[model samples]
Structure formats: structure tokens, C-alpha cells
Target: LAVEPDIWFLDEPFSALDPLIRREMQDEFLRLQDILKKTIVFITHDFDEAIRLADRIAIMKDGAVIQIGTPEDLIINPATEYVAEFTRDVSRAKVFSARMVMRPLAPDEKGSLGELLKHDVKVQEFADQAVNSEDRIGVTDDAGSIIGVIDRQSVLNVLVGRESAGSY
Candidate 1:
């Protein structure tokens, strides 16, 4: 019998397996989702796993769902101490995008910079590459057009906690 369901309700389905095998299964499952396009209720105690696999995570504590959000949302704006504690070790630069910290460009600066990056590019991906530059890194939209620029100071403010990513 061919068995296929529209939804996948998985409850620590990989918990019992060896770590290596579990990782493989997680990769395969994510690939399967891309093909089958099914809604998955993936329950995992591993926070990293949840971050990697789930588009939206529902964190439950004491049998109650405490907060539900995208990984970036939960990490940047933790609803409670418990949520913060869980995401405390996560790397903010890896999770936050240029759009999260970029400022709208002034008219005089449009398309002026010789180098540009996408607005949706993750901050860490390009932050280091532009550190030696004298000016802010220009950010572009999908149409290869400048939309905003991420100043070095702004990126530093976010990384050093002088400014909150959620505030932008």
C-alpha cells in the first residue's frame, strides 16, 4: 500500500538514532519536504535542530507553548528569560540580515559605491569583506538596484549590543 499524508507529525522521531544518522535523516527530511511540500509538526528538544529545520518554531515549556516565531524573531526579541536563555549562545550575525540593520540611503549616495551587496544577505556574510572600506556598504534589491546601505558603525552597534536588531 502506498501511504502518503498531507501533514507530517513528527515527535522526536530521530531522537533514538545515533547522532550521525540523526543528522543524515534530518537532511533527508528537509529535502523530502522540498519535494513533498507537506506541513511538518517537528518536535525536537534540540534547539539547534529546531533552528535548522523548522521555518517557524513553537517553543513549549512545562507543557505550554511559550513563544512561536521564526528563528530570527525568537533570537533577536526573546519574549522571556527562558527564551533568551535558550537562544543566548546563538550567533546574532549569522541570523540577522542586512535589512535588519541597514538604513535608508540618502539620495546623494545612490549607486555611488563601487561595491554592493543584497539587502537580504545575512550580515555576517559580507560584514568582514567590507570592514576595510572607508564607506558604508551599499545594499541592493533583486533588480540589482541600491535600496539601502549598512554603515560599518551600525553593524558594529548591532554586534556589540549598542543597538538592538529588533529596533531597526
Candidate 2:
């Protein structure tokens, strides 16, 4: 990182460390990436680590690339059975966003919508709030304009893995 290269290829950079140290290194890595904004190709057999650090992941098997996509994309629509099994244990709410679970706002229900959440905010971030609210929570875009709504059922669906990212 001292030379400021345009890209970095890290293969199990923290694999040798203890659990606590590995987590700290991962945090530090994220902090450095935020400041440097360098493109990174991080290779790891740890799926959880991949989900935490990668914007896009390519799943490979026996030297063949199986699928490539964002964490959300891979979680929601895995390309093959292997991909599905690979991500089956992941928490859906952690990977899905408000935009991915929200329903389109009806014209008559616009005025009744509850608190607004950003489109990219993950379902896990607001699950408790949404579940406790009686009214449907509104989902907003970058401009803060309401584009959709998420009800208690929607939040529950995500928590229970009954909601599909493509359903919204």
C-alpha cells in the first residue's frame, strides 16, 4: 500500500492470524480501502469473509468459475445448485435491502406511509423498527423521494427467508 498501486490481489491475507486478530485486520483493511479506494481482488475460502469484504464475488469450483455477482445478487439469485448451497446458511435479512423487499406504493396509501428508509439500507438494519410499526415504512432513493413501502410482513418475510429479492 505504500507504493499506492492501482489494484491489489490478496489471497487469504489474514488466514494465519487468530480469530480476534483476523477480525481486527479485516476492520483495518476496510478502513484503508475506504481511504485509498483501490480496487482489490481478495481471494478467500471463507464465505463469511467474502460477504463482509467483497462488493462482487466469483464462486469457483475445481478451477472453473461458477458464478460472479454482488453479494446481494448471489444471495438472491444463485446461478446454480452449488451456488445456492454455498450461500444457504447466510442470513437473508443481512444481504437484502429495503429496495429488494419493498412493495410499490399505492396512490391511495402514499399519505399513510410511515418513516422512510433509504433504498440501499439492509433489511437487518431496520427489521425491529419495521416489525414494530403498524404502518408501512417508506423506502427512499438517493434524492430522498419515496419510491416504495415495506410493511411488517415484508420485514418478517425477509427474516424468515420467504421473501425473494426479485419479488419487489
Candidate 3:
């Protein structure tokens, strides 16, 4: 019988597979997630593997979701000491994107610099752009008004952990 369901609740389905095979299955599962758009309830003991797959991870302690969120939410704001320790091994740079660090471009700001840097572009991606540019890029509001400016120096400072980096 052909068995296909809208929602798949897999409980340690790949537990017996070797690490390499398990990784392949995870990739296939993610591909399915992209196409099917179904709710998945995947159970796993490996925290790293869980982080790699689940959209909204629900860390269970005593059969309850201690915390539930995307990987960022779990990393930035861990629920308990265990969760915190679990996320500590993860590299911050790998998890954080450029959009998180990028400031907006402001209007009435006459500069070709800002025009080149797109919103939510990664710091590393923007770093080269910032270096090549001459004028300071103005961070604009939703209404196209100048709110902040991102210059080569500012971008550099933010990337190297010297300055506070975040989204607007």
C-alpha cells in the first residue's frame, strides 16, 4: 500500500543508519519540507542534528517543550542552562546572517554607496562593498527617510565584534 500523509511524525526513523547515511536522509527530508510544506514532528536525541533539521525546535525535558523557536531564537535566548550549554558549541557567525547586521539606507542621502548595499546583505558580503565605496551609506526607514548610516569603518567595526550589530 502507498502511504503518504500531509503531516509526518517520525520518531527516530534514522537511528540505525550510519552518520553519513543519516545526513543524506536529513537532506532528503529538508528537500521534502521545501516541496511539501507539511508540519513535521521529528524526534531526535542529537542536539546538533536536531538544530540542523527542525524549523521550530521544541526542547523537551520531561516530555514538554521547554523552549520552542527557530535556531536563532534558541541560540540568542536559551531557556535553561542545558539549552544554553547545548547552543554554546554552535558558531555564532554561521548562525547569524548579514541582514541581521545591516542598517537601512536613508532617503535625501545622495550617495552611490548605499544604493549598492542591499538590505539584509551579510556583513562579509557588505564588507567588500563597503571597502570599495567612498561615501557613507545612509540607513533609511520604511518611508525612505534617513535613520542611520553605515560606513566602511562602521561595517568593519561591526564585523570584528568591536561594535554592536543588529537589525532595525
Candidate 4:
């Protein structure tokens, strides 16, 4: 980072560190990346780390790339059984955002929208609030304009794996 290269190729950079230190390093790495905005090719066997660090991930098998996409893509639509198995245990609520599950405002629907959630907020962050509420919660974009709404059924569908992020 001192030299400020345009791209970084890191292989298992924090694999040997203890869990706590590895997390700290990951945080520091994210901070640097935010400031540097450099393209990074991070190689790690840790799935959680890959999800945390990568904007797009390429899953390889036997030296061949099997699938490449954003974390949400892989989670919502696994390319193969291998890919599905790889993400089977992952929590959808953690990967999916409110925008992914929200329904567009209906033409005749006009009333109080209740509490609003940002488009990029993960389902896990507001699962309880959404599930317990009788009315749909509004979702907003960067400009704070209401773009869509999320309901209890939508949140439940994600938690139960009955719906895909792309379905919306």
C-alpha cells in the first residue's frame, strides 16, 4: 500500500493469523481499500472472508473457474450443485438486501408507509422489525425517495429459502 499500486494480488495474506487478529487485519484492509480504491485480487480459502472482502467472487474448481459473480448472485442462483453446496449453510438474510426482496409500489397503493429502510440494508438487520409489523415497510434509495416496500411475507420467504433475491 505504501507504493500505491493500481492492483494488488494477495494470496492467503491473513490465513496464518489468529481469528481475532485476522478479523482486525480484514477491517484494516477494508479501510485501506476504501481510501485507495485499487483493484484487488484477493485469494483466500475462507468463504466468509471472501464474502466480506470481495465485491465480486470467482469460485474455482480443479484450477478451472466454475462461477463468477457478486456474492448475492452466487447465493441466489448457484451455477451448479457444487456451488449450491458451497453456499447451502450461508444465511440469506445476511447476503440479501431490502431492495432485493422489496415489491414495487402499486399504482393504487397510497397511504402511510410507516418506517423506512434504506435499499442497501441487509434483511438480517431489520428482520424482527419487518416480521412483527402488520404493514409493509418502505425502502428508500440514495436520494431518500421511496422505491419499494417490504412485508412480513417477503422477509419470511427469505429466511425460509422460499424466495430468491432475483425474484423481485
Could you estimate the TM-score for every candidate? 0.77, 0.89, 0.61, 0.90
Q: Name model 1 segments beyond 4 Å from true.
A: 13-28
* RMSD to the hidden true structure, all candidates: 3.0, 1.8, 5.3, 1.8
Candidate 3, residue 56: CA error in Å?
Answer: 0.4
Residue 79, model 4: lDDT of: 98
Q: Name the weakest run of 10 consecutive residues (lDDT summed) in model 1.
A: 158-167
Return the clash pairs for model 4, or none: none
Q: Model 1 TM-score?
A: 0.77
Question: What is candidate 2's lDDT per residue for 114-140, written digit by digit as tens?
Answer: 799999998889999988879789999
Q: What is the C-alpha lDDT of each candidate?
A: 0.81, 0.89, 0.66, 0.89
Clashing pairs in 3: 98-122, 99-120, 104-139, 104-140, 105-139, 105-140, 106-138, 106-139, 106-140, 139-148
* Backbone clashes in model 1: 0
Kindly provide the TM-score of model 3 when superposed on the true structure, using C-alpha atoms: 0.61
Candidate 3's residue-wise lDDT over 1-168, tens digit each? 046687788899888999999999999988978888888889888776776787678887877778888766777778899788876766444444444554554455555544533343445545666768787765444565555557776666555544432332
Model 2 vs. true fold: TM? 0.89
Angstrom error of the Cα, residue 119, model 4: value is 1.0
Evaluated against the true structure, the overall lDDT of model 4 is 0.89
